[model samples]
Target: MTPPMTPVCAKPRRRRLAALTALAAVFAVLATACTGGGGTAAQDVQDSYKTLPKESGKPTDGGTATVALTPGLSPNYIYPYPPASANGTVIARGLMWRSLYRPSGEGDQIADTALSLAEAPAYSSDRKTVTIKMKDYSWSNGRPVTADDVVFSLDLLKAALKESPANWSFYTPGQFPDGVTAKATTPDTLTLELDTAYNPSYLLSMLTLLYVMPSEEWNIARTGGPHLDHSDPENAKAIYTYLTKQSESQSTFADNPLWQVVNGPYRLKSFDPTTGSFSLAPNKEYSGPGDSRLDQVDFKSFTSAAAVLNQFKAGKLTVGTLDSSFITQIDALKKQGYHVYGAPAPARFDPLVLNFENTTNNFDKVIARPYVRQALQHLIDQGGYVKSRGVYNGAASPNYSTAGSGSPYPPEFGDQAPYPYDPAAAEKLLTDNGWKVVPDGSTTCERPGTGPGECGAGIPQGQTIDFTLSSANTPAYVGARDIAFASQAKKLGVEVTIETKSLNYLYTNYGNSFAPANKDKWAAQDYGPLYLAAGYPSSNTVFNTGGSFNLGGYRNAEVDKLIEASTFGADPTVLSTEVTSLSKDLPVLFFPTPHTLVVWKDTLSGPPSSFNALLSFLYTPELWYFREQDS
Candidate 1:
């Protein structure tokens, strides 16, 4: 089966992605702003408080809203199909492009651009063939969006997968949407014939990731060459390569005729490469759900979260995420005439991932033991870490299941934490497993075998519990937590050495298979807080054996089975059982989910009331608008 097309916030191993900096100055100001009498106490305020002002009246048209983007991290790729970060994708695709469906605040999928273009999928009796009827929708260039456009986009994705497996997370090597064939049944209809029965929910969700492109404009013939047939492998690869090169060339974004055509609500108006800023104008021809109430939307990039907050304080930003370090500033932000609301807990989490590949100092022998992994989980001081890190209330809590607390899965699975903070429990687990523990010293394995009370196989006697814990050198808070964790582990005779590296280095050198030389260099890695993704939760990409993001090579046959079952849209009860089972397996040492804050000006209106805005904040910008000022 094809991997699900969902929004994933897994740690990327990119070379140039910038680290998020601390807003210490903002913290200092918040400390003072949140204290003193006659105001809402910082601790009393819930992080879930709605910050965006209520839509008191109908939305007023006109006026542009300025948004802030991380400086020096502007999106280089504007095409909707190619791979891009969530933030960049939101601005480049979510804002200017349209998909088949969008996520509702309530965490349900609702039709967006496809509300009129396509009908609910109809499946055959055998569930082998699914048919969709397409409606006539016009592109920005005045051309109709036809069935051919969808087929072309799918072919492009197939070709791009050949060139780069990293392009789509769901794409498996040597596979092409298994036994699937796209054919235009009529000018206004598209039929998808499948060779086997699959999960209709998953199949429909995947369509959201496949954005329709303009075949007439994106075709090879438009590049002054003969028309190339998508059916031909060589031709498809060539067209994909050409399109990819064009997408990578940031300078051509505004001038490219292939990019100018759009069927979405907004169109790119101007781009300032130097400032990493851009503007979007409403596509007058757009016939989607909501109208673009604003005359234009401007995105301004900032060097740091502090800068973004500064813009918010100065009334220069209409909408932006407030760093948690500045949580105490909520009262002050409100006093400054800004509407401060608590955002949902981030969908991502940072966990201490143990390397199971015995290649690293033979550390895998020790880490592979279930008791040892369990001990590490018990040693985590989740509460202290959150308090010290300034994560808001109800935001930080122990998480063990792969499905986040925010996922559609049942809460019982996510709420259960098999391992809680207990130094005694950690110590006993180590000692009972045949480890000679000396408090505040290094632990040495004394028994090595495949029996109860014996350290697992490949572990040699006298092997000390000592290894380095490396964390990404961004988000300043992660580094602090790493040190704290190492300090705590030391009390249990586990000598944890802390090392900080760039995010790119952590992903590429430590995580990805392409860099095997650096694989065994680090024993444990800190890639947490939270990793976000859309659709139903499945560990196929991150937890299954040999999965793409399975950085540490931690494999469990039971986990592999559960993940496979979950992908097929199996019974919720069975899926929940799988989640619960993994919760106790200690696949990775889970941590607390941090509370993310988003603040907007009182002047702006229409933010979604019940959505995973943290994962896809730019999902539907058309719904947002400015209110008319009172005389």
Candidate 2:
């Protein structure tokens, strides 16, 4: 076959494709954005494909999919704002809710920071006040996305926390520019004013999380105190605080339509947390552009690696994510005639976050030693981990670099700062750091001030560290966590322990919120393998110091300085340099990130490339289509 055409970056907006009934025809325009250029080597590997057996050639428009998922979490009415981080709310957002801005476009449109809305923006020469033109789009309730919708969403998110203590913390610094305010100048026109000239490049990508909701629906739920009113300062603060403070994982009125509205491709049909399954139905009211395949996308949840593999063996499972323990099952899956998915996911850095604020105890006191942590990373046998786990075709990789290799981070840097596995360096560092070799040659690190002569206490014979990973109660997660602990810690002479809990308990009590009273909340954190679907913007919430998402207590005056310079400084080179510098330094101990797999019964068609499971999982749905045998 001839080499495929290379994709090129087109103008911010390509000519919109005229409406077409053919599934493939509808997406021809969408594919135009792909531009034939290959992404990173990792992307090339994940996107590898072969011709299917045969095309049914049928344009399928209906079918029901059964999914495996954790069920029975309470819903937060703040739909998009609530924790889409979990599968329960994630299914809803992907199915029912749509955002005002999309990763590639303002929302459902193409991504072009300059030409944003349908018509070009009418920016003042000063670029301080900018006006946006709304599209001829409507919510599932048949209401249009007016300037008020934008105003309401921004102000309501700020207000929801006031009405409900449990809210989403999605908005802050990099996300919403400093000293900026939004309001509806007219029904179709939305205007925004900033205190300073924000970086258009970064600001544009950061706006992807902005979702518009009907003013009435948002106001009714958020302002439980006052009647419907305009989006003004009098109400903005109250709403912003309530929404920001809300505990979405345990919200009471999460799934109510009084707040949830569909303006995107599909609508939420039903969900059974007990069975770990979520069902979505197509929305007849959906009028957004592009081709949609499959009547709905179903998520089947499973807590145990064994269960997910079992379901895969049962043939009912179409998509899945499992621990490396399922490494042996890849062959079984292929023998049974199933496609295996693999790739490094985005926005994931299984960072070994050190608590800078914890002045007393430090489980990683020895490893946190600058040179020590760096040496330990080199000791990680990424290839061995893959072969042992037996991931998709032995396809898994170790995350050596902090800036995601093929991710929004620089691809060149990975190759440039190559730190191949070196166990020798690890042992040498231990020897230099006052660690003595045992009679048989086994090595162990010693604590600084504990010997009888030294502070009149026995030395911490060997760095025996206790780490507690407080995630939701799930057998699969625990299994994965334990696997890494046993292997990686064994190499470093550290005995690591695992602790798990419920999402509500962990997310609320043990998390970065207020400190928890009992040691059960969390002693130390060990989390992993990030799955980010959305492209990374420099303004990541988790990375910002003193930011709400700063859960793991990572702080560095130098790192913060570099981050600050990158934020305000112009030029991608400077940004790349600083971000690259951070990736090199031991900010976090990153492990491998795997892809999010999506599978259909071989009757559906999607984009030429499949996406990795990411922070933004809703991106590729519009690229999928169904073709039945009869067609």
Candidate 3:
């Protein structure tokens, strides 16, 4: 339920994880060039981890590092919890207010205890009661981050949900804060009593989204007013209203007193609304891991990937991502004194979201049929798409299920394509289902009935398989793959009309939950990958019935039960079973998981793990510093 990442521009609302900076990984190395570290980089290009030079030299004093924000995806909201239509990155959240549990960059680990604000939760035997102890952390205002702050944050979150479910995308009507009672039993101890027992892993995953705010500072309903107890429901609601209203005044973000009192590694120094660029200075009061040696970190935004690449070529960008379409430039970028690395981001998947509520061209009825969905899935050439130079350029791996490659909870099919690309198979499935066999022309339903070998209910004779694909306008590969799919569908007599839209536009207007009026406007959308929590890949809010982020109104009784089992049941294997069912159900059209190619200046050195976090679209600039020589 983390923030869903569009391949290029725009990061849609808050969910479980933070904003995705870019796009995935298959470890194949492209050729490497000499680096500023005075070493020949790994040459095979197939080894994903060995491409970057080893960390060298001693840490130096104050230096400013420029980070490239994903093209078109820049921070616009300072609040941790954002509304459904909240377009733009929420990167400022992690930079200022630290989440209770820090997400691990490693695939095998769930949380990074060294960076987390709370110790791991201790669950009662019945599993309905949980206790969490706050770490020794302080806010910029010199106040201890107490358990009362945690309770206050939860209260405000509940208030946001009470106002409207859309205010917080991760919310379900009766889940988490809805039925749980949070208590600050001691200054550092916060306890929770749940109505229903939840899987420990699942509950911990939920805590990753709970960011601790300074209750002492943010408890008031008005600026320059007396601080009220946020534990009161009405007071919490008023405080939420006030904070959200203040968050909308983006012009005052840098100067706002509410925002300056941060608890994370860095504090906002300036924000440019015009360019969506911003700068950060290390918080002297930060009490977390690593030395905040870097004096400043500047985030740069661009209108297109081309502009980012131009900056990289000119050695203007210190840290950023390179588009897969420009894969050929890897060696040249290495020679430009940049360290380039690529990997499939953990717990991430890209799909063409199918809007089942869209009645346009009767697509809802057409796509409802399992055979038809399978046929359409067949039209996608996952392998060819990965191999295509204009597509992923050998930087992506073919993924057939929601449980992406190397998942801890892989489906039964496990990397094998359930519906491998075959135009003949697509045609055969349609023809067997009473569709007229028309090559390169409009095919219609020859037999319309609710019986075997016939078009399903609500579909009539002469019904054509036609729909519009709303494609994102960044990361170029999105359009390339859509065109390829359309061409394949064309050969099968299915018409897929392509319409391009900006990622920002798609993030804001394409979701059925927020923009139900526009449901029929788009049959399908291909914005990009949706990143869940890396260690625990739960589809709670993404695929479950009535999920806030469920852009497509996809519903299935068995799927709902499976999702429920994964959420509340203690059996870890249930996640595999759930994803397996989702894979076969074809709720959304699965696309190849593209490897995000992360490029950074070689002179900027830190623990290699810090750079590795970039592959997952995570920023830990606090751990980074300039080498002594470079500084």
Q: In order, what is each prediction's RMSD in angstroms?
A: 5.1, 12.4, 6.4
- For candidate 2, the TM-score is 0.73
lDDT of 3 by residue, 244-327 (tens): 888888899999999998999999999997778999998889999878899999999887899999999887878999888787
Better of 2 and 3 by TM-score: 3
Ranking by lDDT: 3, 1, 2
lDDT for model 1: 0.63
Q: Please tell me which model should have the higher lDDT, number 1 or number 3.
A: 3
Rate residue 386 of model 3 by lDDT.
77
Q: Give the alpha carbon lDDT tens digit for every residue of 1-631 in model 1.
A: 1111122222333232232133243234224332232342235356435444456546788988887763224444576655522223223575555554543333333234343356677888776777877666678888887888877777777776666666665554433364678887776678888765555655665565567777777778337787778767677788877876667666667777777788777888887755557888888877766678889888886655677778888888887777665666777888886776554443344567777874555688778888888898888767655555233333344556655556566435456567888889999998898888888887888887778898778888888888888776544455556666666788889888766664434544565433345767888887444343444444556777766566678788987777666655425345556557666787678776555566777777775452235333434567777776677
For model 1, the superposed segments whose C-alpha errors exceed 4 Å read: 1-44, 47-53, 70-73, 81-91, 108-117, 174-176, 343-350, 389-398, 411-414, 504-510, 513-517, 528-535, 569-573, 610-615
Better of 1 and 2 by lDDT: 1
Query: Which 10 consecutive residues of model 3 have the lowest summed lDDT?
Result: 27-36
Instruction: List candidate 3 segments past 4 Å from native.
Output: 6-53, 85-88
Best by TM-score: 3
